[model samples]
Each structure stands twice: as C-alpha cells, then as structure tokens.
Target: MPGYKTHMAGAAAVTGVAVAGIYWLGFYRPNFESMVCLGIFSILGGLFPDVDTDSKGRRFFYGAALLVDIFLIYKQQYRYAAILGFCALLPAIGSHRGWTHSWWAAILIPASVLVAPMVLLGLPWQPFVPYYLATVLGYFSHLILDGKF
Candidate 1:
C-alpha cells in the first residue's frame, strides 16, 4: 500500500487533473484561495481512510480535531464541538479497512462538507459542491492507491 506521502501526491495529482478538466469545460473557475482550500481538503480526505489505524494520518487528524474541538468549546459552540467529538470517534468504531474504506463512505462522508454549513449556518449547499467533489476525488485516489477501487 502507498504511504502517506504517496497518497498525498496521488490526491494532488488527481485533484489537479479534475480541476483542469472542470476549467476546460467552463464549469467553474476557482481563485487561488479556493484552489488552496481544495488541495487541503483533498489531502485530508486522502489521509482519512487510514485514521482507524495507528498511523501518522490518525495522529494528524486527531491532533487537529482536538485543537479544533477545543477552540469550538472555548467559543461556546457546544453543538459543533459535540459533533466534532462524535466524528473524531467514528474511525475507531470499526477495523482499519472497514467502513471508512468503502465507496459509499467516499461519497457520504464528504457530503458533510456540503450539508453541515447548510444546516448550521444556513448557508446554501451549492457553494460547497467543489469542496465536496475535491474531497471525494481525494478519497477515491486513496482507494485506487490501495487497490480497493
């Protein structure tokens, strides 16, 4: 299986191709900041499937989650913090290559990027479509690299 660096590179390559295709088709044009955010999301998604195991991905995600959850709590955003806490525990609910590695998860898990802001901040879901797609693509790259797709 590919290591973290390989997975990250694969995700970046896939994301670049996808963005180029989208741009060529005149579908959307992302600015520099949006592109950077997309890359970040894709990289995170690429690493996420390994979060159930004792790997660098798990530590990075959990460490970041801990900091974010703490910030949310400090800001009195108890509901968001609770949600984050629950999500951070999800990977540990199954084995290393369990639900998190499934194709359905590749789609469904990323949908949170689209749904959460809509539900919590009353933001429109349409604006988050690219982010959702970027994450899914990254996740698919991981699956491909692992020969699971």
Candidate 2:
C-alpha cells in the first residue's frame, strides 16, 4: 500500500486536475474564496482516510476535527458539533486498516463531515457542491493509493 505522503500527493494532483477542469470549462464562478475553500477541503480529504490509524495522521485529523467542533459550538451549532466530534472519534474504535480503509468509510465518512455543517448551519447546498466533490475525490485518491480500491 502507498504511504501517507503518496496518498496525499495523489489526492492533490487529482483535485488540482479536477479543479482546473471545472474552472477552464466554466462550471464554477471561479472566485478566490471558493477556490481556497476547495483547496483546503481537498487537502484535508487527502489526509482524512488515515485518521483511523495510530499515527501522525490521526493526531492532525482529530485535532482539526476538534477545532472545527469547537468552532461549531461557538457558532451555536450544538447538535452538528456533537455529531462531528463523535464521527471524528468513531474511527478510533477500530484497528488500523479496519473500517477506515473500507469502501463504505471512504464515501460516507466524508459525506457526513461535509454535509453536516451545511445542514446545521443553514448554508446553501449549491455553493458547497464543488467543495464536497473535491473532498470526496481526494478521499477516493487516498483509498486507491492505499490499494483499498
């Protein structure tokens, strides 16, 4: 299986290509803010799949998740904050290469993390579509690099 660096680089390449395609094809409005958001999500998604393992990935992922949950709480999004916190911690229940490396986890885990904030924060779904797609693509890149696909 590919290591974390390999997976991350693959995901970034995939996301960059996809984003460029969308931009050149005029699928998105091509704003700096949206592009930055997409980039950040894509990078995080690349690293997300390894969060279940007892490695540095876990520390970064969980730490980020914790910060996000705290921000949610500050924003008064109590329920979604709790849910995100739970999902962040959920993978630790399984051993490395267990559920976290599975196909289902690859899809659904990112979906939950991406959608929950939208639902709880009353953000429009349309703007976040690219972000979601980029993240999922990055996540799938990780899985494929890890030979899970």
Each model's RMSD to truth, in Å? 1.3, 2.4
Residue-level lDDT tens digits of model 2 in 39-124: 77877787777877766667888787789888989999898788787777788798877887777776776675456657776776
lDDT of 1 by residue, 15-120 (tens): 9899989988999899989999999989988988999898888899899989989989999999999999998899889998899999999999999889989977
What TM-score, to 2 decimals, does candidate 2 have? 0.82
Regions of model 2 farther than 4 Å from truth: 71-78
Error of 1 at 68 (Å): 1.7
lDDT of each: 0.92, 0.77
In candidate 1, which residue ranges exceed 4 Å CA deviation?
Answer: none
- TM values, all candidates: 0.93, 0.82
Best by TM-score: 1
Candidate 2, run of 10 with poorest lDDT? 109-118
How many angstroms is residue 57 displaced in model 1 relative to the true structure, after the best TM-score fit?
1.6
